[model samples]
Target: MLKIVVGGQINKKEIFDYIQNYYGTENVKLEIKNDLDAVMAMQSGQFDYYIGACNTGGGGALAMAIALLGVTKCKTISMPGKILPDEEIKKAVDDGIVAFGFTASHVEQVLPVLLDAIDHKN
Candidate 1:
């Protein structure tokens, strides 16, 4: 099973619920953590992927991840008025992005694509 950690300034519960519902408990294990602990877990190899949501997607959702995991391993797939294309998200998965961030409002739209890509990737 894939292990995913939820860490963001907002929508932690919603994102966790969405992933659990769509991916199912059988397919993935999830945990909600504060940004620092989450990033540390990720860096220490305790989790496979990270999902976070914020207003801008980048600033709050990914700042800790980017700072700890490095920018190359992290990505902001959506922002306030912008969401990356499905192919791009898939490409990010293929290119090895282990952490993803998006605006809280884009959770429904982004999770399907992101989780699908992650499912296929594993």
Candidate 2:
């Protein structure tokens, strides 16, 4: 199972919907708030990765990654361009989870690059 926490926007259903399309709603989760809440949720050992959304894609994701570093082996994937298809984002999260071993700091640094790779299908 892959867990995703959503940031930005109140109605996070759209993001959830997108993610669910590929991974199924049961696999994807949503937390509609800032990075703090996202990190807290991750600390509970419920999710594998933290997925945050922002207009720029750095602020919320960075905040969550910083909080989870060294504590939770987790990573974050942000869609800055907002062009990522649902399946692509899902695959990015999955691949990140595999390659990074749930290290939050590593995830933070790799998320942008991961998204780019996903976008380009690299």
- What would the per-residue lDDT of candidate 1 be over residues 52-86, giving only the tens digit for each residue? 99999999999999999999999999999899999
Alpha-carbon lDDT of model 1: 0.94
RMSD of 1: 0.6
lDDT of 2 by residue, 1-120 (tens): 445565432324454455456455564454454656656766776554555544444454455555455423433343443343445545654554411212233333434554344334
The clash numbers for all candidates, in the given order, read: 0, 2
The TM-scores of all predictions, comma-separated, are 0.98, 0.49
* lDDT of every predicted structure (CA atoms): 0.94, 0.46
Model 1 TM-score on a 0 to 1 scale: 0.98
Give candidate 1 regions above 4 Å deviation.
Answer: none
RMSD of each: 0.6, 8.4
